[model samples]
Structure formats: C-alpha cells, structure tokens
Target: MTMKDPKSYDLLSYIVVFLGFYEGVLPFVAKSTDWEPFLSLPRHLSSPAWWIVSGLVIVASFFSLWGIDIAKKRRHPDA
Candidate 1:
C-alpha cells in the first residue's frame, strides 16, 4: 500500500503558527519589567527558556507552511 501525503495542512497547524508568532514577539515588545521568568511570558523574553520555546514555535510554524507547500506540489505537479 502506498501512503499518501496530506493534500492540505490542518487548521490547528495554522493556528499554532499564528500563536507561535505572537508568543515569539510578545515578550520582545512588552514594556513591563516585572514578569516572572516561568509564569509570565510578555515580561520574560530575556529568559533562555523563553527564547528556546519561542524559537521552536516559530521554526515549527515556518516548516509546517513549507511542508504544506511541498505536499501540494507532490499532489499536483502540474499546478
């Protein structure tokens, strides 16, 4: 049996990408200085853990979009 690549990416994947972009930028633009490293996101952009989380989400979203394009190309090479 030949496995098929999905013709389209799911809605949740798009949502993640949006949320990820927000999560990644929120901390950087936050004006508040009193934020807990682990509890507060908008104020903890300086935290290494936060950076890692943000980077992961952003990269994941980007790759998700890229994968969607690849899948579409494979399914419809003429398009």
Candidate 2:
C-alpha cells in the first residue's frame, strides 16, 4: 500500500499541538494573575466540561503527533 506524504500534514499537527498547549496552560495562567479580562475564565475553569474538553484536545494532539512520527518513519525507513 502507498502512504500519503506526511509533510503535507506537518503544519496541521503543529497547530493542534499549539492549541492543546494553549488550552491546557491558559487556565493556570489566568488563575495566577489578576488579568482583568481573564477573571471570568477562571470561574469556568472549575467546571467539569472545561476539563473534559481540554483533556480531549490535549489527547488528540498527542495522538496526532505520534501518528505523524510513525508516518515519517515509515516513509524513510533507513533514516
């Protein structure tokens, strides 16, 4: 079977990583500072829905990175 070019999706994978990182870290930053605009965000951060969605996005990003790595290795076995 032929494999799709992994390079084509590198940008997408990186974007997911960024988003996951942002989602996971934003709440912590919001809570630790007195940033006026983020005051309300800290409240929602305590909800179960917030944790679930953040966890899902972070997990998805991890899997996406792993898949890309496997694809690249399969495309270049000797490397």
Among these predicted structures, which one has the highest TM-score? 2
C-alpha positional error of residue 22 in candidate 2 after TM-score superposition, expressed in Å: 1.8
Show model 1 residue runs off by greater than 4 Å.
Answer: 1-13, 31-46, 77-79
TM-score of each: 0.52, 0.58
Q: How far is candidate 2 from the true structure (C-alpha RMSD, Å)?
A: 4.8
Q: lDDT of all the models against the reference?
A: 0.58, 0.62
- Lowest summed lDDT across 10 adjacent residues in model 1 is found at 1-10
Q: What's the lDDT for residue 35 in model 1?
A: 38
lDDT of 2 at 24: 55
Taking the tens digit of each residue's C-alpha lDDT, what string does model 1 give over 1-79?
A: 2224342344445665667667765555443454334533534545677668766766776887787667666776655
